[model samples]
Target: MRILVLANFGMGLYNFRKELLKELIKNNHEVFISLPKDEYKPKLEEIGCEFIDTPVSRRGTNPITDFKLFMNYKKIIKEIKPDIVLTYTIKPNVYGGLACRVTKTPCIVNITGLGTAVENGGVLQRITLYLYRISLKKVNCVFFQNEENKKTLIKSKAIVGKNMVLPGSGVNLEHYNLMEYPKPQVVNFLFISRIMKEKGIDQYLEAASYLKQKYSNVNFHIVGFCESEYKNKLTNMQDKGVIEYHGKQSDVKRFYEISHCTVHPSYYPEGMSNVLLESAACGRPIITTNRSGCGEVVDEGVNGYKVKPENSNDLIEKMEKFLNLSYETKVKMGLSGRRKVEIQFNRRTVIDTYLAEIHNITER
Candidate 1:
């Protein structure tokens, strides 16, 4: 089977779904990946996927640009005439699905996250939902990363096709196997995600500020892309010793290994947070919001704690709880987090599920 995989970013494909693509090749399938070219395009090409550059402004929602993106997909899909089309993220799922529909090609869409447009609930949300409904109408299958999102899509009548919930994108257990928890003199807390307001960076910063003043032995570290608007402010905070910001790391495992705990106070409508799962797989306890996919990873006082969304005081309170914990207790919590990922969110499960669906779709 000839498979076409579509996404907004090539790096996302390289980092997250490279294993799946390799498996398809091993099964004697020709794979083509379509996304905006980035540093990772060569990596994807190296893995035997024919890379095609698709026009996608990941942060833009301008109609004219989006229409061009839609037309691009139409042109590419028609030219390639792939046997199966698998898409991820918003634009590819909506516009790419629509283009696939025109070619009468089977589409399998993975809803990674809804993003702020849908979560904010406004004219954009309505427009996005309408596009989703129309695009997904003729899709062969829809895979949602979490039950909350699946329920939302179904309830909103955006996805009326066969749907299944996956464990976010699933963590590669072998790659993220348990590591020795850091025994740093200072209790270090880490936040790993894109530095966006929606990701609850403000809450993390606020908690860090209060905790730093109260406890001199606590260290706050951030590892992720610092968005333009927050760069100067984060730099200021770093200089003042309010926090340690390492902008956009490719390998977060080292950060997780050195950190006492991982904090993800994200209020973003995520499919599931890969950061939390990776941290868990590395035997690091988590502190996150009690909403959507973030809440599901934590077992509340078992592997970690769940705090109120966007509430700095609550985050501070949880950080204090971690500070008060005995070293053995924290280690035990980290081990528990690793056990949870082993039992439920292994990447092989995700790969097998996709292969099974691919077989089913192609056999027909």
Candidate 2:
């Protein structure tokens, strides 16, 4: 079987879904990926995938550009004549699903997360919903990362066809194996995500600034690419010894090595927070928002604490609560997190589900 995948970027596919792609090839399936060409494209080729460089505007809503993207998908689908198409993220799912439906091909869409505009409602939400409603009607299956996200779409009548909720793209347990729980004498808290406003960077920075002034033995570390506006702020903070801002990292495990906890303060709509999952898999406790994508990972005080979205006070309180915990208690929490991932979010389970769904659709 020939399977084609559409996505916004290369790292998202390479870092998160590479194992699935490898398994597909091992099972003797021909795999093709349609995405914007990037450094990871060469690595994807190394895994036996034939790469199709498809330029995508990830954040634009321009009708003309979107029409071109749709046309590109239509062209790719027609030329490749793939047995099935799999799409991830918003643009690909909408446009690729449309192309597949028109071409009379089986398509599966993975709703990684509803975008901020779609979730916030209003004119954009209405437009996105209308598009989703039309595009999803003909797809073979839709995969959602979180139950809340799935429910929202269903309630909004955006997706009425067959769909199933998946554990947020499941973590690669082997790749992020459990590490020995770190000593928290001088606790290091790491924040991993795009340093954008919607991702709760403000909340994190606020919490960090307030906490750094109060806690003498704690450190805050910011990871990922900083947005333009936040650049000077991060630099100033780092200069003042408030936080360590590593521009961007390909290997987060090294940072995780020295860190005691992972804090994702994102209010952004996400199918599931892989940052939380990977942190847990690395045997580190997580502090994240008490909302859908981030909420599902924490078991109250078991693995980590949850804070109210966009509330700096709540975030500060939680971080303080985490700081006061005994070192042994922190280790236990890390162990609980590792157990959660091993039992509930192993990547093999996610891959099996994908393969099963694909086979079911193809056999039909």
Residue by residue across 222-332, what tens digits does model 1's lDDT show?
998888999998999999999998888778788987889999999989999999999999999999999888999999999999999989999999989989999999999
* Alpha-carbon lDDT, every model: 0.91, 0.92
Minimal lDDT window, size 10, model 2 = 177-186
On residues 146-220, what C-alpha lDDT tens digit does candidate 2 reach at each position?
998899889888787899999989999988988987665699999988999989999989989999999899999
TM-score for each prediction? 0.98, 0.99
Which pairs of residues have clashing backbones in candidate 1? 224-248
> Which RMSD values do the candidates have, in order?
1.0, 0.8
Colliding residue pairs in candidate 2: none
